[model samples]
Target: MREIQTKSTSRVTAQATDIVLRQTDSIRLIFRPTIIDNVKNKEAALKGIFLYQKKSKKAAWEDFETIPLSSVKGGEGYKLEIKTAELLQLFQELTQLYELHQKEGVPRGQKRYVQATPQLEQLASLSDSDIHSFSNANVAVGTSLLSKLLVWATSLDDPSPLIERLVEINPDSLSKLNAALGMQSLKNALASWEENECISDEEFWQESLTKHSFVLEQVFSWPTSIVKGKAYVGGKNVFNQDGNIVDFLLRNRLTQSAALVEIKTPMAPLLGAKYRQTYNVSTELSGSIMQVLNYKHSLQEDFQSLTGRSGDLFDSLNPQCAVIVGNAGSELDDPAKKKAFELYRHQFPGLTVVTFDELFDKTRQLISLLESEPRVEVESDDMPF
Candidate 1:
């Protein structure tokens, strides 16, 4: 290492060490720190920059081309210029050298950047092929990988090329990726449904809907009318100080028109004892529909006041109400029962009633539509594990 001295306007002198970060057959790169005192002038103080090859390999390595300091301290306004492939390699090597130094130079008191630092390091150790194998792994493992990636991505500076790749990923590619992920999520929801089919706990269903709000989006047959909304707007759908909570307070993302959702356990009956020629709607189902309607009316009456207080724009104009209850697959297996249930639900103006099974079945049909293209078959024996 060689020392370079520079004198400031105040006659204060600071020394910087010339450290060779990388060297090849015909090129060399050195990190020469000039000064570090940011009190007077940050630009002049931050003049420490990279020095590239400017002299013969055998000669004293004094002469070199200076790389802009902004390249190392990356930002949106900064541009890194690497003319030749050799210089690019040197830059990469220099970055790796600095990364190793950073790894060894952890500051006192700050234990780690993230909670799962060791897991992140282990995840970083995975090869391309090893990471590819994660496609077949469990959800927990996949979530872990995503968590680690999020930590790493957030740690990087803004305008990072790695994150910018998302821009190059066209809309069609994103749609396909989204469809694949949606298919997986729907499948998971189905499995969860099967597991909790016998469960009558209302909280379980509520929590499930909260965890997967996309499932509620499937409730809307007209997808174009509404965009996604938070599962629990105003935190648990509390629109007023009265502590009145709705299961979900959905809104048309474009129109801001509100919708109230009321949920009941899957075990809730869809129909009751036969009366006259048709079976009557179950007390539970009817009660839920009424509950959602009441919430809708309350929301409509308080819309302007709530909007003024919260400063959130929403319309309660002819608000829609929906009730999700019972397993239609089992209860509506009878043609007469199914028809009665459908007719009863349709009678209510501005109200929609959907069974738990029917809601997920809509999701299943959507996934089928997304994957309707002709598939190329690969023999099991030829398939790569």
Candidate 2:
């Protein structure tokens, strides 16, 4: 299932080259710079981090290797609840890595207990020894390392309480044996955003839509309040017979054709060079509008075949748009790109568009506006199909 909260935009063009250029930040930062700087030696820290990661990943390999139905009998409900709980806990911790600090675990100021999300607490598969170690631990990654975590965690709203506990663990527990023994803190090793002495880094580089989506799944998959639906349907590999699905078909009613996202690193521009040229608001103006024209075309074809609707709602009517999301006072300044994007928008009316700031503003007030009313009523009993 997917979450309901999000921002939307229209589609654009791309190909194999686009795919190559489209590497998510998650894949780019092997180990956070902050973590590396504090680890004594870069190579050694990376090795340690990888080892920890590999340890936690055994669950995936084990689950994949084992065929559930054959291995377990009865208590399927309990078994499912157990596994889902584990995955959710893991996902929450992984997500905290993309927040403002970019490290892992919880940040300063917030309550530590929030880390114990329902899934984390419900995970009973953990071994007794591992549980003991987890309970009595104090994580001591360096300040730089914590800074990186802040960057990553900023991407998420609030991590689970267990994650907060992991971040506070001691360094000794991160060793090979300790990590393999179910060191949940290892997930934080995914990133270490260096809070370089440059205020520019914090000022300019804003998170993009793609980056937002990437962190969402990592941070929270099974929501606290479940959204009943058939499945999630975007980020590639999502298609339905009609642009429409049954009312309950989607876990999150807030689905879109495709969205374009851009990543900004506060001071990426001040560093000059390629970073300066690519990050300007004007430069990114077009980035949001044209994220997935190719995907839109593909969906159009599929939707047509499935629904056989009268008009070209599937083909000619591709309502994909762009969203220039990120921090405030961190907008694009380039003029040419802005002009081109403006021209494109004037030409396309159906395409929804906005910046991350704009999206945030709307989201905050939207809840009240929506609550004031309700979903549009459907008087006709007949289904569109």
Candidate 3:
């Protein structure tokens, strides 16, 4: 939830007319562009991302664009209640396959494929009536089964460990274990264990099946684009003595916010902004310092008319913050990466450029949180939705 305060001098581009949210299983994608191209002196590249969210005063499960990426912690904006009956049928079939593996010792190791078992064949051959019968008898059961199967299929990579353990515990009668009156204890155990456990922590499998990796597919910098210039034309004319008037008064989110932000990787043009006189005065990483300074200056001069309150828009007590974030590899012999921060330190003195390691771990946590709760659905009407 804590972020590098980002002070920007560019207006987000693209005034989207409407947006659509698309989903398949756990993945939700928003199909539209949100970024304003203030960089490169050209129009902003509007790209869309489908991600969960945990951000903001409104906390609306918005169309992703409603909140800043920096604020959308690992929070899935909202969860669509998945169907139950379909999930049940899938779960029953998967359980059968799992039981067969236990009885046959998982055929040594079945990371990808192995000979089909009778249980698997039976499950595959189930008639529509059979699946429907189970669903009709117990709607909850059906939904639970379907949900489990879907989660497992989409999430699991190797079921060897769960299979091997089951097989080891019950010799050839893995499927015919404890049956009380009409309940199956082994089945229940599998249900309780598999449904609640993390796929990565599944010890039944030899190793986790797949890997989840996130790439910084795209990123944008604040203020002047070497190509397009700043968001405001005739840059000087855009500001008054109060700094960033229209943007500050209009952007309550900007005037009353803070974060720890940076620019790294393919850092060529971005670093160019650090050479200005305003930035040269600081001992911190040049880029961030300059950005903050620019943000402050712009707001002070331009925002006065709108807010009718002048002086610093950012709270000096809690004014916006800026930090350089670069890859850990930046610390290596790479001259550009090392030199950027080195100059950063010489200029900013106590400024800290966060390493890629911290960036990665923190981002991963944020992503996970987003995928779950999503911090959507506004909590109050006072906060902008």
Candidate 4:
């Protein structure tokens, strides 16, 4: 490394073209400084920090290969580009340098390392034995390395390295992996319902819809309807009169018309009892329907005020209302009970009533559609002469 010293009118600054701070048998870390244009007044600044690798210890420093670093258009901070191949060795060198710096005291204008994230703290706490055991662990070790590689690879300007690896994977295998992930999500949602069967907390159900607002989309016959922002819109309108908080407020992406949804637990009964010949809608279901209807009325009444405050144009004129409650598959197992429930909902105009199981059943169908392989028809050219 060539040492370059320049004198400025203010003070004298001394630096080297390449100052090796840390080194191993084959690799070395260096501080490269930018040479000043004029020796009179200009002071040289750090151009970059780099890692250089040599084939062997006996190799000349001039012939050392420079590892590529992330290019900063113009920034005060320096980012060293570390590849997966040299990650472990670089990590070891960095840790030792950090320890030495801590003992000596951090230089002026340089910030000392602090454990910010939980991940960094855990990494800092790892001992040599712990690191050895971690590196030797089975597939877990590979998984950790792959995760790091994925993060690094995705951040690159040209991510074709990761893309190439993915392309090498069989298409059928990729499809299967995608299907498995979809099935797992469906199973997780079902498991939540199963665990909280008896719990009738509206907030719990509300939270589920908030996380997976796609469930609300199934209520609308029009495919364009979607939850505008959050599933829950505040109860009160501009006037706050006759204010009733809606569980979910969906809008047609094309028409920009709004829709209201009220959520109830799956355990809520769909039908009460046989009145005359057909079953009557359960009191809980009846109340929820009325509640959603009232919410719609409140929204429509303050349509202009609400729309102005929201800043998004929403057509509150004749907005559709829906009530999602009960589990039809489990509760209305009887053909007669199912027919009565269906007839009532179908006959009800401007309002939709859907069962919990029915809503999730639609979600399952979507997953099935995603998992199903497309049929390719082959055109045969054969003449029967």
Models 1 onward score TM values of 0.57, 0.24, 0.24, 0.55
Worst 10 residues of 4 by lDDT: 1-10
- Candidate 4 local lDDT, residue 273: 84
lDDT of each: 0.67, 0.34, 0.38, 0.67
Supply every candidate's count of residue pairs whose N, Cα or C atoms clash at under 3 angstroms. Answer: 0, 60, 63, 1
Q: Write the per-residue lDDT of candidate 3 for residues 68-186, one digit (tens) a residue.
A: 54665575454434346544543443443334334532233212334456866776688879989968999998879777875876576666556665656655454444323113322
**Deviation of model 2 at 204, angstroms:** 16
- In model 3, the worst 10-residue window by lDDT is 209-218
Better of 2 and 3 by TM-score: 3
Candidate 4: lDDT over CA atoms? 0.67
lDDT of 3: 0.38
Candidate 3 residue runs with Cα over 4 Å from true position = 1-235, 238-288, 306-318, 323-325, 334-343, 346-352, 355-357, 365-385
Candidate 1 wrong stretches, greater than 4 Å: 1-162, 165-176, 224-243, 309-312, 374-385
Residues 72-107 of candidate 4 have per-residue lDDT tens digits of 355545656655645565455444433433343222
Error of 4 at 66 (Å): 39
Model 2, runs deviating above 4 Å: 1-288, 304-317, 326-328, 332-347, 364-385
